[model samples]
Target chain A: MLRPWMRCSKNWRAMWNNFKSKFLGTNFKRFMGFVKKEFYHIFRDKRSMFILFGMPIAQILLFGFAITNEIKNVNIGILDKSKDSETIHITNRISSSPYFKIKNIVSSEQQIEAIFKKGQVKAVLVFEKDFGKNLKSTNLANVQIISDATDPNTANTVTNYIQSILQDYQREINLGIPGREPIEVRSRMFYNPELKGVFNFLPGVMTVILMLVSAMMTSISIAREKEQGTMEVLLVSPLKPLQVIIGKVFPYIFLSIINAIVILLLGFVVFGMPVQGSYFLLALETVLFILCALSLGILISIISKTQQTAMMISLMGLMLPIILLSGFIFPVSSMPWPLQAISNIIPAKWYNLILKGVMIKGVGLRFLWKETLILLGMTVFFIVLSIKKYKIRLE
Target chain B: MQALRDITFEVKPGELFGLIGPDGAGKTTLFRILTTLLFADEGTASVAGMDVVGDYRDIRKAVGYMPGRFSLYQDLSVEENLDFFATIFGTTVEENYDLIKDIYIQIEPFKKRRVVALSGGMKQKLALSCALIHKPKVLFLDEPTTGVDPVSRREFWDMLKRLNSTGITVLVSTPYMDEAELCNRIALIQEGELLVVDSPENIVANHTDSLYKVAAKNTYMLIKDLKDFKGNKSVYAFGEFIHYTHSNSDFSEERLGEYLEAKGHEDIKIVKARAGIEDVFMALSEKKGTEV
Candidate 1:
């Protein structure tokens, strides 16, 4: 039995080598030439060049800086009626912190409201008269933090930061007392709850860039051929429809992969956001999502007649849904049931989950098999639909 | 939107055929149907002995098509476009360089330049070279000289004539009637219908009516007075003179000159003129309009 199996293996190996040589002879040259032409086309166009490489880096950097929780140089007005060392010390501490910048000081309580009304400050700190004396005698004092509510989210963060600074001052002043624990309340935010890390936005920006370059660019380029009449020449040539499509998308696939690598590097270096899981698995999943987007691009190009229509449909039709309903910004669980059901159909939604899971959650394939399967399923569905929609001849 | 109806013609293997018509005459539609880029809703056609519908893949491999528009990749350099077309047909440019060398040599100096930087005539030449790189049995050129200057258009036609002489059957369409005289055979088309198909000599020779070229100092009044005349069947402005044909076969130029004199026209000239393809096309289309 062992001898027969060895003989069969040798025969199969010879057949495989023969098949490889035949296909690699003529078809390989044709395919490589086609790919080279596509590369020249993309490299020579300045707009396409900007979209391909420049867009990913610009988008990643902009989003990385936008979402970090660091609130620096927030202007504020202080009303200090108490002329004492303790009041001055607390004011010095608030100004020293990076979060607040004191723009003005008011001697009267009425002037505090005037500063806010004048828009001279985003927030105001008011201290009561004789604060130092009251704290020394009663062991308690009050400070009021009034913030502008025009932007409620920033106001909340500003007020929360001021309260914590005041509490810190209270703890520092009470340290000399003996036989007291001071009732310390230490709060720890788990898994980057401080929102200081750029990890939360990394996946969202990567999805948007990949979708824009991979899907929108590919669709518009193919439609450009149609508009310019080059597609008619291609159709009349000996190239098969599948070969034509592969030739057109080969350069985009390479560029999209490079774009993904650039985004990951920026996330790691500029943002210090690391992938906690295996890099190999992340790359494989990324390739899967790119395939899905490319297939969608092919479908769009088939239906569109010109580059303008392709660009319009890709941006207004595909990009909007990926940004809005992919849970990249808003959580899917919080969405209504109908929208949640629709979101399940979007590949970016599943890919976003997989990106977060592998990069932030440190989960392996076993934990993310469902999302991976959904993405894989979407890839196949889009590819098959694109093939069915591909037209061999102009109508 | 029936773009064509009952449009039929055939080209011999070695003869150069021209589809002569004006714009909107459905020449491009027929070219598309033959090149396997479109499907006919009612009729069946074959290209080089292969059915366009059933054996479309073979038809595509057999014929080379240059659309009415300049359709090559404008961003790709001239050499790159040629090499790309050659490779896709599984043949290297060097292998078929003999076929395209005559045409490609003119644009060789600018082979490194992108197609967008090329002039209208050079772009047309490059397009033709790319179409011929594979050395197809038949070539379809649709309005190849629509936007070129006079010198370039003449050079472009000279190349086509040379290609035809080399035993490559050429099916070219043009809105310019003068180019019709250069082909071995021609088809007069208008309004999605074929008016007639014959050799250039036969088309003009077949014009039955006796045509007279009428000239006067006041060209506008000459046409007006002729249209007002009763015996003339058709009056058209052909170049600097008005070509008029009468209803009766024996109507003389002297009689027409006398009629113009009565209409207060001075220094009138009328002579029996030999008909050309343009004269035949106009008459045939006007006849077709009346029949319809």
Candidate 2:
């Protein structure tokens, strides 16, 4: 027989006691101490600080400005055997485009191989004889384009640019002619109208910088403690292993956030890379990716016995895959089937997809839920595996 | 690989115990287990009356460990490192200042300097202070004086004696035989096996053979010559002198001196000497090797 108010007060008291015990059980004060020590380690070392903050900005700027996939100012050798008005007009049109510069003109086919071998010209274009006559009489003409196939990507892109320039010239010539209706395929580039390489590379740089700073830095820091023998001392203390790991990871999380902001600002200010979506959503997704990378770092630290090993594994095991297989430099659809399947497991792949979706496509969570879910799953998997591996090493 | 096997020893409360062994004698492995950093596959260990496996959390709060290497944060200042460790242990430097006052005061002048800039002796003192800041019940130090200078080594032992006087149990491991005399009890281990465990005096008293120190002009050749002596049971070089124990209990130093003279050795000096812990350690290791 208790009053209702009294019953509610008793329940509240019990709840408060449970909450207090749980808070005391984890020893938050000790965890804060570990986190503070980690900050001291980060701030005291000049070299590590440079690697943490400077490297990210440098990498982002380098990728945005210097490194590119687009072909421009390529040197080509033209062997115009026809010497007709149409052939001359087409040659002039090709040279006018900024994508190519006619470096050499050969008199014979034999000179084509010699010029290509000299490395002065990457492509050779030979016009068939009577090119203008054939176009007027049979409404067709033959032209050959031979490019260095050693670098297949560059070769393909160069050939495509030349074909598009020739097609445009054909439309201009046939515009006033009557009784010949040529079918023209109108193609337009969306989102990036000029096909600026920086636009495509911005999201990739963001993913790589975040992944490297978060995963690689955290792993190296933890492995350093083990190498110096301080990890043993930490284990002997009353701090739980989970607390130690969280404390080590917390500082990197803050650093990685700052790095993300720096990269976004540089991309916007220097390259004019647009952030079409909500900044808040982009930030939330970036944080999710950073957590995934941090957990991956923890897993690497647990398996490594020394800082050098941890660094090597983080670079070779994680960075290379993120660069090659995460669709950062190459399109995933064009990759080999096996590589495509393997890319699915790389967390950066999902993060890159989400970045493009949110930042470039201006899509909300509804469009990016799948990628977000994948990143969340990877974070959970890495954290769980790290904990299990840590326990096994302790035993 | 099985790093340890059939290892068994005990340390009483308020007693200073020593694990005397060389580099690969599994001393570090044993210390790791006792500190709850590692698990033994086939046996059990406990620290501060708590099981190392089941009650590791309780044991962790009651023990402090300093590994063989200098393990403090090299980038952080000495004071920062000390403060971090103390704070993590739910205590402060002021709370445990009395426990580490002697060692801490030595390095207080350079407290603002980074640990990497400190001399070996100062680093040792800083590590000791950090380990003691928590006021742990049992302190496990694995070869803390291995790379330290001799002067620092002696000072470290004095510090340990003072800490032990406060009723805190200390377990320390070292490879130096001379350090064995400082411990109340020592376990001589080799190749992951404990050959003998006893007080230094008792271990020396248990030696049955009459030991002699023999030195000549050519010490190396003298050792080669002494190995062939018919009365020799064990012969080893000890600094400037070769410590020789005879199979025959009645063997005399004069007889050994005469034998060396017969071997074309000049300026020979032979004297009866007392057995030391080093001698006992060598004899026990040899006996254990034969038994194996």
For lDDT, the strongest prediction is 2
Weakest ten-residue segment in model 2 chain B by summed lDDT: B247-256
Chain B TM (all candidates): 0.97, 0.97
Q: Tens-digit lDDT track for model 2 on B18-127?
A: 99988899999999888877878878887888999999888888988898888889988999999999988999899999999999999999999988899999999999
Alpha carbon lDDT of residue A51, candidate 1?
88
The digit string of per-residue lDDT tens for model 1 on B72-162 reads 8888889989989999888888998888888899999999998889988889999999899888899999999898899988988899999
Residues A123-166 of candidate 1: C-alpha lDDT, one tens digit per residue: 88888889899998887777788888887878888999998998
Q: What pairs collide in candidate 1?
A: none
Best by DockQ: 1
DockQ of each: 0.81, 0.58
Chain A TM per candidate, in order of listing? 0.88, 0.84
> Residue A158: error of model 2 in Å?
5.9
